[model samples]
Target: MTTQTLDGVTVNTQANVYFDGKCVSHGIALADGTKKSVGVILPSTLTFNTGAPEIMECVAGSCEYKLDGTDNWVKSTPGEKFSIPGNSKFDIRVTESYHYICHFA
Candidate 1:
């Protein structure tokens, strides 16, 4: 898959902070007005609560995650994606720095 750049989109550079600064993301709006974030996670375990459903695409590296109400952890690598439901929380563990694109729906 190819990554599309959102022209004329204003990015929120200080949004979506997690793990006390270990994980951070910037918000961007698509041409159709869909919101998303491109972020990087450091090697750490973090839990995040979502207000809307999210599809996280692994752009570089990999990470393991367990969704809310799920006991099994799943691994996602570059080009792989995982979905999380709205109003839910999920845990993620990363060994190395992981880069991802988060699409909010």
Candidate 2:
């Protein structure tokens, strides 16, 4: 199911801007100390490198992502998710907007 709300999270007010502000996100910490990020990507193709494993969950809109070393571009819509390994990178293309939550693992 889609995560419509994050009930108990301490959010960082300052946004993490990337790709010349084409992508932006706010980091949030849950009660149990689980860190996550909620963000939106504008219309652009961006490459992101991960230091830790991450699961990208789409909450609204959609995106097409190509994982490192992969030839296919997979579509992620609302309620869908994709995983990226630690120390890896992924390419994402957004035509409209992609609202997502990044779950750290």
Q: TM per model?
A: 0.88, 0.98
| Per-residue alpha-carbon lDDT of candidate 1 for residues 1-105, written as tens digits (9 for 90 to 100) | 535454777688677887787898899887678888999999999898999999999888889999999999999998899999999999999998889999886
Reference-based lDDT, residue 34, model 2: 97
Using TM-score as the measure, the top candidate is 2
Where does candidate 1 have its weakest 10-residue lDDT segment?
1-10
Q: Alpha-carbon error at 48 in model 2, in Å?
A: 0.4
lDDT against true structure, model 1 = 0.88
Can you write out model 2's per-residue Cα lDDT over 24-46, one digit (the tens) per residue? 99999999999999999999999
Tell me the whole-model lDDT of each prediction, alpha carbons only.
0.88, 0.97
Task: Report residue 77 deviation for candidate 1 (angstroms).
Answer: 0.2
